[model samples]
Target: MAMFVHVTSAANAPRIRRSGIRAVSHGQGDARGVYCFPVLPSYTLTHQWLRELARFGSRGGLVAVHVRLDDDEEVLLGRYADRARNAQATVPAAQAVRRIAELDDPRGWEVFVPRAIRPRELHRIRTAPQVAGWRYRPDAHGTRPCTCFGCRVRGGYGARRLRERLPHPLDGPPPPVRVLLARVAAAGEPGDPVVLREVLHWFGMRRRGPLDRLAHLAAHPDPGVRKDLVWAVAGWSTPGVGDLLDALADDPRDEVREAVEAVREPE
Candidate 1:
């Protein structure tokens, strides 16, 4: 089935293209196929757009809505006519894309969408300068352990072990650095959030030789990877870093441009 993705920010375009979906203009009239919307807080659904989507649904077009409320909660909605189906799961974006790819028809929409629920609002304290940093304080009495598979795996010794295994900048190239760089080289699959996050974390840790080797990932096919790479290279003072930031400044994704602006020093 042909899929059409309607997005507000250029950042979402690369992901849609990688998914083999066509990008449709907001005012396009021929979007009568599978409609996909990536809901973000900054964009509001206009009345005309809503009416058009409803009309598309009434005409038997399928609608897919993906919402990421926080790190812990995500909701996917599917609507046809007045009937709606949704699914709430802690699956990463990559897994969600795979689930959507499995559906062959409208009848299988619910398989990708589940029933939705109201998400709890999250609040964080912003440090001075707004860009300086953030302080997150969870409710001590109400806090509970996350039981999602990814959380469980992260809670294990993996993160700790990885941190411990990272090579010291003064030690020159180390075994862990080689291994991490190898993973960075093989991170070509679309929507593989886990691998990309790990690679980004490793690159963010030290600004030594290994990080320089990963400058190529700045143009990774996955926007998520590029976003993380921008953050990882933000603090570097290398000449290549400046050129990389300049190239990414014109990126279609506003998120990438914002990241570039964040690290860019005033002239």
Candidate 2:
């Protein structure tokens, strides 16, 4: 016996039909348990992680619990891009369901388990397909993304219009405050901190180039390029923008000294 599904978040199906599928583990340091996928005689590769776990659902409904491990239960398995790699973590549960049913692209395998699943080995929850699998991984549709700065997603929603329409050579499409004032006046290295924080997210538009060549990027040693040069000169009223926000409020990076006191608390 071997069957699995998981998918999740139809408002967690009534607390997983009361105390059943709980093992919760999310982001940074992942691996607490209960991450399924394996029933594949391909029902879309057995619910390939329903649109990447319905992108952390805050209202976006999704489901699919289904269970029943039995065959020497004890899983861990691998490769959803090496679930934070550590090599073939344990096995058994019917040999990780016959090693992803003899994979011919088991769409990036994954199977965890490590504890909770009770409500008598579940076996039903239903209503899935909130736009089926593959969102930010697995065969990442036609490639070219990984824009690097740890795979881009800060301030996400359309993230700066997808980095100015597919940019990212070192992350950007930003460069013309007259060619960044000729690369900060022909320097030995003033550039790539993700393209100088994408050209300081447009120093509040219509060009803002010199202040002694942007006050030496307030000692820029990359706190995301001095929090994008204190958020592109936080609405400058220039008079050396308060001594470049007092030399970036002595930034040692608490997000560039809290964005230099959120740009001097809205003056």
Top-lDDT structure, candidate number: 2
Stretches of candidate 2 exceeding 4 Å from the true structure: 5-24, 27-32, 42-140, 143-178, 183-199, 202-212, 216-229, 232-258, 262-267
Q: TM-scores of all models?
A: 0.33, 0.31
- Each prediction's RMSD over C-alphas, in Å, is 20.7, 15.6
Each candidate: what lDDT?
0.44, 0.74
- Rate residue 125 of model 2 by lDDT: 92
Evaluated at residue 65, the lDDT of candidate 2 is 84
TM-score of candidate 2 on Cα atoms, chains taken together: 0.31
**For model 1, what is the C-alpha lDDT against the true structure?**
0.44
Residues 1-267, model 1: lDDT tens digits: 111223123333334334533333222233222233332221222111332333222323322323333332232334322132222343543444445455443221211222221122111111111111111111222554343323333334344554345433332222366787677567654536668667666556465444467676666776777888888777766557778788888888888888888877586
Relative to the unseen true structure, what is the C-alpha lDDT of residue 24 in candidate 2, on a scale of 0 to 100? 72
